[model samples]
Target: MPRFAANLSMMFTEVPFMERFAAAAQAGFQAVEFLFPYDYPPATIREQLDKYGLTLALFNTSPGEVNAGEWGRSVLPGREQEAREDIDLALEYALALGCEQVHVMAGVVPQDADPEACRATFISNLRYAAERFAPHGKRVLVEALSPGVKPGYLFASQYQALAIVDEVDRANVFLQLDTFHAQKVDGNLSHLIREYAGRYVHVQVASLPDRNEPDDGEINYPWLFQLFDAVGYRGWIGCEYHPRTTTAAGLGWLAAWR
Candidate 1:
């Protein structure tokens, strides 16, 4: 069976950030993940995990200046220093929380910025991050966001992300595939699962058109779940979607797995 992780950042909005850990555990999740945990000290979050016996599946490196419309810095040219800082900070939290995977966000590309230059910068930054995290036996991930969600995002397709990963040539750097974006940008879901079975380190899911629970989506998650097992994908499938109703109520789809 495929393991699932509750994305606290999106789910469990009924409570505060710290309280979501307990809510996830109470909902029968063995592992959990969130977008950014920088708001709270690692020890504090670690306490909740320890208390609830939940494992930290994955989290992202800090996105630079959200207010300024920057989603990430790794893909931004002339911002290598900031990218390095983000990686270093992420490493600190990963070690403290005993997490094994970290998603390195590829920032938005300025309209006037040269695409090739941004690609080169992203490659360099990914290599640096991979090297930094490899020593600790952690994996680095790169994800493709749909243009509708993040316009001008570095790359909006899994193939593009794979190409960049190939160029980086780092063993620890891998793709972080999201079903929502994949369905939006590239439809052949089954083909993708079979083609890149072991290449991706993490997976996320949500309903297309609405980005809600996986129970109702254009992409059949039930079939995909079986496909994941068939292809030997031993990574956590993160629940990275908005709950149409309460998170717990919408989690009926997870009943069998639980």
Candidate 2:
């Protein structure tokens, strides 16, 4: 079976951090990930990870404003200093907790931004991150946001993501595939996986249309997981979804996955 990690940051938004980790553990998850662990000290995070015996699969950099509702900004142009600080903070946390992947947050693109300039800036930043994290045995995972979310997202389609990966041109900078955004932007999953197998390093899923568990929406996760198996792709598959109700109530897909 592929390793499953709970996306504690998004999936369990209602619960406290430590309690969320405990809940994922009680539900039989051996690992969990969250975004922006900047507030919690690295020592405390290590203690929690040890207490739950949970491997840390992924985490993202600071979005500058956690409460105003920003996910991250690594790809935003003219924000190199901010991105570097965020990366360093994340590195500190990852080292303390043994995190395997740090999703290099491509921040939202500014309106009327020069496409060529933006891509160049982002790629350069990615190389900086990849080089820094490679020596530490962690990867800098780049995720493509659906264009619907932000204009000039830099990498919306699998091909676009691959282009960035190829340009970043580092073994340690890989793709982060989330089913929700992938379906929204690429509209094809299996074929994309086959075409870009080597570039992929992490996978996440939420039901189509609703962004809930697999059972709550249109996509067939059995088919999805089957495709993953067929392609011989193996890594930490995360449950990065939002709940229509409570977090626990949204997990109806667990018993349904074979």
Q: Which digits, one per residue and each the tens of the lDDT, describe model 1 over residues 67-172?
A: 9889999889999999999999999999999999999999999888999999999999999999999999999999999999999999999999999999999999
Instruction: Residues 1-258, candidate 2: write the lDDT tens digits.
Output: 556789888777787877787788877788887766877888888888889888888888787654644456666678788888888888878888888789887765566677777778778888888888989988998888886665555677766877888888898989898888888887778778788786888999888887777665677778878788788888878888777778877666675442
Q: Model 1, stretches more than 4 Å misplaced?
A: none
Determine which window of 10 residues in candidate 1 has minimal summed lDDT: 214-223
Q: If candidate 2 were superposed on the true structure by all CA atoms, what would the RMSD be?
A: 2.1
Whose TM-score is greatest here?
Answer: 1
TM for every model, in the order presented, reads: 0.99, 0.92
* Model 1 steric clash pairs: none
